[model samples]
Target: MSSPEQWTHPEPGEGPAARAAQPSPEQVIAGLRATTEGGAELTQLLTPEGERVASPQFDRYVADIDGEALRGLYRDMVLVRRADREANAMQRQGQLGIWVPLLGQEAAQIGSGRALRKQDMAFPSYREHGVAYARGIDFRELMGIFRCTDHGNWDFKAHGFHPYTIVIGNQVLNATGYAMGQKFEGKVGDEDGEATIVYFGDGATSQGDVHEGFVWSAVYDAPLVFFCQNNQWAISEPTERQSRLPLYQRARGYGFPGIRVDGNDVLACLAVTRWALDECRHGNGPVLIEAFTYRMDAHTTTDDPTRYRLSDELEAWKLKDPIERVRAYLARNGHADQPYFDRIQAEADQFAADLREFTFNMPEPPPERVFANVYAEPSAALDAQREEYLAYLSGFATAGER
Candidate 1:
């Protein structure tokens, strides 16, 4: 079998051999048809129960990690999945306006998130709840945005996690720009200097900002990693509707290396991301990681998967659930048992209960507080406008309001 090194790059100007060398266009079409027909499954790293599978490129890193670390990685996936489920349920119960469930992509997020060094920073899309969890942000804080409260209440500098960017792919440019700043500050080469990672979805690949992000990162040799979790669907559209070629292949065109990792495998995701970040820290410029996984839930709580997809398709992905696969592997290896499983479940439940209490008790910001920080300094014109607005608001106040 060809090693990951052999599969890492294609001949210049040639497409991915597996994709391009398919016997016929009819075969390609048939393969996609099979996926939709529930005959084919997406790439996966862990089985429904967690077990370690070897991949040539990732073997180097995974070999060095201890069994305890592997168990921790598995635990992170489980906790994140539980949080995703709770958020979805909260949204459905009308407690939140919307929720994006990271149901099947926990490995992609957790693995990559765990790979970050303390100095490294991450820019995330709104669906990056797992990343947020890894960064030590309280999961309930994520509810603030979807709950129609604050934009981002956390400090990015303190946590090394930027506020989740809702505008598709916009954070890519911001991440690149920050990395370029780091390079200017002489922070790209040394082991101690910071690196940046940005996450975006497969659908965002079609946007202009994503392309622009690539251009800037490549041109400046920024210490940035563009992590794309290709979860098969972009809202209601399938990957086929977005591009003809696999998304990873696009990286070579811009003078950077790209790797497609089985995103469903936490170990693989961690290995790949750690390697990519180290490459950047070593002055290798930017790298793109296309994490091949699936979104086993609706695009958001407001979405109806049944309207545009099939139950069998979701079932196929369920077999590759990131958390289950690790658990399976651990059990098989005699590294984990029912007691360990019970403890983890209890921890997850406690987390959910704490989050529920915190979310319900979250204090609302005062209405005038919105205007307090709108400007660095007060201007006469702005002050007059504010006064007029206050007057208009007070017009509706009762006699005791003064």
Candidate 2:
């Protein structure tokens, strides 16, 4: 990671020579007004006050989702938020060495996750806790890696969710390759269908692998959706440091449609994700969705936001709280009651307790366990190495034990 000073800064007035020559004060003022009043439609279907806004692209898709379905989406956000908070608490309590909190991005993950079909495959980066929850993965399983007790406790093949990829943008390539494989396997546009969704953060977008993934997807016309969660900060580095233009525009350069959606709005996320997946399934090639969101917590348990950010900014984002917005919507529309909210809280608490118990009792893998899976077939050299390691451990025992 580079120091803040080393990061790029957008030159406010350093573009085309013709425009730079002379801009009257009046022209500059007009330009600023136009920018503020008219730009792109940063797609949003849900407001911070929980009112449903009109979005032509998504309105038709969400029209059939009844009140019950809306409530279910709200529930998903609540439970996922609880699990996220518990994970953070556990990390702080020393139960785990580290944690990456998905504190404010529940709507983005849940919306995208719920939109995914059973046949769809998801490739996630490390911070996608909500994505894991939506995919039916036990929250405890996620803790295993951070706790250093296990290597991917869940079955990736069974769940259609890849194990969390820690390397910044590597999963982008993996996802593209997987989608390309799907194309080769004649899985594209089949009546029996599937598509791939790859998740990465704004920080990852700066990596070469992410760009390569986009190029490959475009060249192959692979069925993949590159979901970029622009969570404002990438471990203290703002999105501006990574790119001058919005991340979504990068996709357009690669010959695919790029969209910027309000990631904090669950309805928009689901609607957009569903459309992207359908486009891929129908062999429309790749799509990129820039989910404009904010990471409300520290980058991870080890991170201290105080060093680089302001509390006032965080407080501002709180007003756009993803879970609270949905709850407000539910309450205002009479889709949910006090009992419903209470039950959701209770369920969340139970889940946290269960996770605590499971993590506490997680068995440590034996010393020899490390050697067990080193190779598919044991070699003579490996057998000798294992024997030497055993002897080394034996040499440190008490006299009687030895």
Candidate 3:
């Protein structure tokens, strides 16, 4: 990470060249305005209006995706979105401690997630519900974490999906280490070689851990793909505040290739990710992909977007709804009819209902359970602390006793 001193700050009115080079605040905001359309640098195979765009270079990656596959992707997004909305409502109803809504970024997650081979592993940030669904993890398994009952108890090795990482950019280091281990074990250099993908947000790029992960992975040539879901906001602060250059462009400095893709376009994300993973499998490791998407909901159930950003910005993004575009594409192509759409919606509703029932009936975990997984080996110190906590908890009398 570069320090303040390392950053080149051109003084005001240095020259016309300097002014043009260093954009003003308004210019930075204006740059984001163009992101909705995804500038020339963004790789997009499907337009937001359901138009299919030609991508000569990457078409082969997704050539196997026919109308049926497209419909499947659409179904995946719908179900994921429904489950997300259900979780949000659960949080509001006091069923969960907090909920991280992955409302508009479904395409970015599902596209990349579906691209992963059974041999490949994924390290996900907290808001990767869509990815979790694509990974074949039971959706019910995820609710326990948000409900504060379990520490993501799902078996990682079986599903090839790591436990949700709550800390920003921390997963990058973990993923890098894992990928380095794979490289050391001679897992690369063939079509069947293993690769790892780590998910992080645009805001996480500021973390020193992420920088360290990048340097280490590059040095080791680890079979890793740095997946950045650049949802345009790091919980309220815009991307401009995080970096002057696009997040993907930052990969060049770390000695790797970086590309931006339309996050709303699932096809583009799938194609780009497949290409990156293929490169890693063949020993050309460490690619950075910035999925230019938007987070349509609050950062979490605890935060309010209205306090910082305008509704108009969100409305503009609504025009590029990830799920809507896919539905449009399926409808216009006659691959799916009104009946299929209705059936999917009904199924999504039923999925949400099942999740709601599970959440409502979730067993309350004992407070001492938090100490269970702190260490693999028994520790006297941990035991003492746990006993002390248990004693403190026991001090409270039940209403019946009172």
Highest TM-score: give the candidate number.
3
Rate residue 67 of model 3 by lDDT. 99
**Clashing residue pairs in candidate 2 (N, C-alpha, C atoms within 3 angstroms):** none
Please provide TM-scores, in order, for all candidate models, with all chains considered together: 0.86, 0.87, 0.89
The deviation in Å at residue 43 for candidate 1 is 9.2
* Candidate 2 residue lDDT tens string, 1-402: 112211232234533322332444444343333222212547888888999898777888678777899888888888888878887888878889888889889989999998888888999999888888888898888888989876676878678899899899999999999999988888878545679999999999989999999999999999999999988788987665466456787887899999988889999999999889989988887999988888898998889999987787688789888888888988999999999999998988898889888888888877776676566786899888888998888777855584
Which has the higher lDDT value, candidate number 2 or candidate number 3? Answer: 3
Residue 87, candidate 3: alpha-carbon lDDT: 92
Off by over 4 Å in 1: 1-25, 28-30, 33-49, 372-402
- Assess the local accuracy of residue 250 in candidate 1 as a C-alpha lDDT between 0 and 100: 89
Shift in Å, residue 276, candidate 2: 0.4
Off by over 4 Å in 2: 1-39, 371-400
Best candidate, lDDT-wise? 3
CA shift of 182, model 3, Å: 0.5
**Residue 149 miss distance in model 1 (angstroms):** 0.8
Error of 1 at 205 (Å): 0.4
